[model samples]
Structure formats: structure tokens, C-alpha cells
Target: MALFGKALLIWLMILLLAIANGILRESVLLIVVVKTAAFIVSGLLLCLCIFIMTYLALPWFGRLPASHYWRIGALWLVLTLAFEFVLGAVIQGHSWAQLSEPYTFKDGNLWTLVLCVTFTSPYLAARLRFKQGSKFL
Candidate 1:
């Protein structure tokens, strides 16, 4: 239960990072590049941020087994999808098609790649941390 709580907290932090990334995408990237390019760049940036954050937060998981790390990643993925679809459609008034557009890979949107990264980051981070024998871990 404690581990699950910690994972949820970490996920919330990741959500904040994502929100910041969205702001950057809107304010900076969109101005600097075409919409397609901005979407691609934003997705890649988010993936890098997620991986780095997961790496840094691994110590908080306290030397968990790899399976636990995988579970954490799965949890994050599910939470992200639910938030994107539910909140985007209900609160934001985006149509279902609009919400699903990114997944179509049209206009260079890299949402699918971003989701893959989100699902794998925790396990990948844990592997790297274990391989490096991080003192914090």
C-alpha cells in the first residue's frame, strides 16, 4: 500500500511535468516551428523529461525489484490515458475524435511514442539505476 501511494505521488509529479511541457509547447515551440514539428518535438521532450524524472525518483522506490518497477510504469500509463481522455473530453470539451487524433500519427504527432516512453520509463530507469549501483538506491 505504501509503495502504491508513493507511485501515485510520483505520477502526480510527472503530470505536473507534462503540464509544464504543454505550456512550453504552446508558448515556445509552436512559435518556433510548424504545428507538426512542434508536436513531435514536444512529445520527444516529454519522453526525455519523463525518463530523467523516473531515474531521479527511483531512489524513492527504495530498491524495489524490477517487477515492481514495471508495475509502477503500468500504473503511470493507465493513469495518464485516463486523465487525457476523461478530462480532455469532459472538462475541456474536446470531441472524441480530437482526443484520438494524436494517436493516429497524423501531422507528425508522436503521442504513441510518448505513451510508449511513459509505459517503459520506470522499468528502464530502475535497470539503469541498478546497473550503476547508485548510492542513493
Candidate 2:
């Protein structure tokens, strides 16, 4: 329960960051070489934020059974993806195909990075050693 609460907070933070980035994306797009590059850059930026959050934030949740990390990571991924889809469909008025476009990497979309980060963050956080060479959340 504690693990889920902490992971949910982290996921929410990441989601807010992504939404803020999307809002600013239009201005950033002006200087980008292409749309695909912009997408890639945004995805990378979000991943970096995830890494930082995992390092600094996870500790607050306290220690957990090692196996919980895997469940938390999976939960984060599932919830985040579901949020994205619903936001795209209901709020943004994007069609199913349009929302699905991000996962279509062959078209040069970079959203795959988002998935990779989500899937790995909790487990990575669990494995990371923090101050005093001790394991953290």
C-alpha cells in the first residue's frame, strides 16, 4: 500500500511534466529540425525527469520487500498508458488511431521512451544505492 501510494505520486508528477511539455511543445517545435526530432527530445527529457525522481523521491516511501518494486513498476506503466489513452481520446479529441500513433515507432515517434522509462523506474529505484551505500526505496 505504501509502495503504491509513492509510485502513484511519482507517476502523477511525470504526467504533469509531460502535459506541461506538451503545452510548450508548439514553441519548441519552431526550432526543431523536424516533428519526429521534437518528439524524441521531449521523450528523452521526460525520461531524465523520471530518473531524477526515482533517485530523490523514492526514498521517502521507505524500504519495501524487493518483489514489490516489480509490481509497482508494472502498475505505473499500466496506469500511465491508460491515462494517456483516455486523455487523448476524451479530452484531446484524438481518435483511437491518432492516440495509437505514438507507439508506432516505425513512423519515428519517440513515445517508446516513455514506456521504457515507466516500465523500468520502480525496479531501478529499488536497486539503487543511496547515501551511506545503503539501498533505498
Highest lDDT: give the candidate number: 1
The list of candidate 2 runs beyond 4 A from truth reads 130-132, 135-137
Worst 10 residues of 1 by lDDT: 128-137
* For every candidate, C-alpha RMSD to the true structure in Å: 1.4, 2.4
Candidate 1 C-alpha lDDT tens digits along 45-65: 999999998888888878877
Q: Backbone clash tally for model 1?
A: 0
lDDT of 2 by residue, 10-121 (tens): 7788778778777655577537657777777667777877777766776776776767767877887899888988888889999988988788884455678778887887
Task: Tell me how candidate 2 scores on lDDT.
Answer: 0.74
What lDDT score is found at residue 69 in candidate 1? 83
